[model samples]
Target: MKTQIRLLLLSLTTSVFFITTSCRTELNEEIGAPQEQTLTANSKIADLILKTAMNDGSGDNILDGSSCFDISLPVTVVVNGTELTLNTEDDFEEIEAIFDQSSDDMDTLEFIFPITLIASDFSETIVENQDQLDALIEACEEDQEEDDDDIECIDFQYPLSVSVFNENSEVLETITFTNDEELHDFIKDLDEDDIVNISFPITVILSDNTEITINNLDELEEAIEEAIDDCDENDLGEERFIDVITSELLEVQKYKDNQSNETNNYRDYIFDFSEDGTVLVTLEDNDGDDTNNVTTEGTWSVRTRVDGGLNTTLDFGTEAPLNKLNNSWNVKKIQEKRIMLDEREGEGISKDELFFQQI
Candidate 1:
């Protein structure tokens, strides 16, 4: 019930492929990346120059002189006194190239006098006739600013805060962001292996003070349903459900297939879940040869829903129970002695189902 980092039905994996294309394409032009960088007026120009070009590179955060890492073709940058049609890394090298270098060494270039940069998508940034590139580099040492702690200080873009909560409806932590630079620091400090999966209703307080709340599991499912309803289902449909649940196996307690004339074949089934994400189903062979009973195995997992509920699933190369438990189910009670899974009105496996009890 409290704020937690839970599922938002956002494509966690597919988003990885298109995140730069989707999010970074329209970064605020007024600010530099890594906003906590200390810079003189000269280095500010350089950083903005590199940041804008790297953005144009589209997914390469740093310039490495490769085509993928190269700033796109036919752009213009007025460095020193020359406006060059900068297409490739070689074109950039015309300004300055080091041959006495280590292969791993990052290639470097300093802006010239009366510097100006023109990106493919952004307007021009100009610094007119200040000093030569070498003179500006010399001034960086003289102009570096210091903090109260005597460390070099980089200007930040202000601060924000986000709240985190847990499954028991308890406050876990409230994270504060001092600035855009601090945001990078916070991400860099996180241990991916140590990240905990909490129940949802996670709230983000942006710098401009707006709120986005993915309240519950049903809401996410509704979002997917609505998204499909708004467009053709053939287009990126699985991307819609990818974040909700990643293929969990549900135990077949009592399956009553309405289309089949089957009744007594559903008893004496037990489920075993292995650490390697394998689900094994052992059931009594009422209809088949008793001495040759087989074990059906697949994959399984339970994830926290947006509403603080849990989804339990089962799959063995089919969609009987997986399709059923894919929807949100409330937790009536859970303890060492017993567990209760409450199913709501939706696409369910059974018709006369009351509740699930495991003791």
Candidate 2:
């Protein structure tokens, strides 16, 4: 009986040790093994953010910018056994958190719905990051320059021009001159439709090549219209007129001819006045296929009546021309005419100015 009791006790002790050891082994495995995470296909949230970054004024290449995000921590984006890093620029960490919470269980291969970018938390964070982003852009840019190829040059397709005239085709005012450096300085001081009065003497040539010097505004306007009406009417629609009158103006019409294979072409805008001072402007490309028929309806006014028309601030009304051009920028020089401004990581604006003489 004593031998049996001792054997029984030993057996009990051994069983308990085995059970504890087994429990510990399981616990260790759980602690050591990586959690099975369901990796979805590349997220559209990623794509949209990347698209915005591409146009973002930071000038960083979009692909390079995307690659810069290193997501090696609390946020993990896994694809086909490969893990990519997510850069923290633009407050992507917030996006990562949102993506984490929204992802459903499928710890390995999973087709998940896209992450939302419009959530209040995400939106606020994105906006804040965008505001502070300029501070961090310099460092990001340096990193990009080191890691990627230079960005391709963005070229403007058309040379632009703006000329003012009276009923007799008189050139009242013109801003289509070259001399980029000086023009840039000139435009910096003037607001839109704010008639920038200038008394510079300009030399004009008649259809007979008879050059006449005019110092007064009245004389200049008269001479300009006569030259335009009298210049070879056949060559009027062509770029030669622009080139002869306004030096350095690109022959966009001709240049576009070389790109005739393209479905979309530049739209021509001709702002002219009738005898009764009615502005009749047509916006259409004279050349190209039917696909090129894109036009926008817009209003026009002489600079004098722009921005409340020379009245004091008290008389200001929203209907004034200055109001239309309130926040708009103008170009005084051809070289400085093309401008590309990025407002945030994903939003950008580009503008190119062309100038032409009324003559």
Candidate 3:
């Protein structure tokens, strides 16, 4: 009986050991295995990723005159007889001001060549002369009749994070991109089975400088599609009007306050905008006479907004009636002898209108 009991105890002990070892092995396998996730081939999110990562050519379109590529900066250019070293994107406005100096004269821009051209894929080509630059522009124009696929009106605010997962849904790595170039290359070289999940709550800036938060892939794709063509991407319209504002001797023809439902025929005030950022304001006597005119000096400037839109700002230093017009006004319409400007009150709910006609 003693031998049988000892044998039974040994058998129980062996069985417990085997059971514990088996359970541990199974648990280890489960913990070590990778999880599975799917990123569909040619998916909408994938396409959006590619588009967002594409090079933005419109930012430097003023320099290259092409929407397909950007001219690398620190280039010298002669703008209407004025030599300017354009080291940054902000210097483009100086060129525009030069072009606006004279509406009647032919605006000229001559680049000091041997400048670098950057393509949509971040490839670089050295353009030695005007001929080479022209060739590139011609090729780009022929290739794309409409605007390029790059969505310039909206930009992804960077330092974006993404996770790469394997077939078993195990995260293999996490990548962070600080710029479009890095993000573009990574997405372009993605493998067929690689699953990339973007860390969400990314911010996108619209052409109006409005920020939108995207929580998932669907929202990002939708935002890009909606804002792709929402802005004046070419800035051609703005360039044409800049000349009109600076050249004409303008008088306030009408003013309307939307909030108070008031209208004023401001035919008494004449404005002359000088290229040197000064304005001569002449206030005519309200009694339908030019005899008792009061002349005053004010400052005027055409400023480029963050979205690339232009705002004409006027400051008269607390002068009555003119002080009321001291806000940054958006150009609404530009005609041969008349320009219309409006000031909006919060998301354009209400507005004050100001019309200027050449005197």
- Using all chains and alpha carbons, the TM-scores for the candidates as numbered come to 0.23, 0.16, 0.56
* Residue range 1-359, candidate 2, lDDT tens digits: 99999999999999999998997566434332332211112332222212211211221112112212221222233432335344434433333344335333222211121211121011211213332333333444345435432111111111212232222332245555443223323333333333233323545444455667655445544554444435212211111221232332222221111223221222254333222213333345567565675433333211111111111011112543212222222212112112111111222222322232231
Predictions in order: lDDT: 0.35, 0.30, 0.72
Residue 206 error, candidate 1, Å: 33
Global CA lDDT computed for model 2: 0.30
Q: Is candidate 1 or candidate 3 better by TM-score?
A: 3
Q: After superposition, how far is residue 54 of candidate 2 from its true place, in Å?
A: 28
Going through the candidates in order, what is the number of backbone clashes in each?
12, 24, 6
State the TM-score for model 1.
0.23
Distance (Å) between predicted and true CA of 73, model 3?
1.1
* Candidate 3 structure quality by residue, lDDT tens digits, 139-203: 77555434455656788898898867554553467799999999878877887676666777899
The stretch of ten residues in a row with the least summed lDDT in candidate 2 is 304-313
For model 1, the stretches where C-alpha displacement exceeds 4 angstroms are: 1-265, 286-290, 319-332, 335-338, 346-359
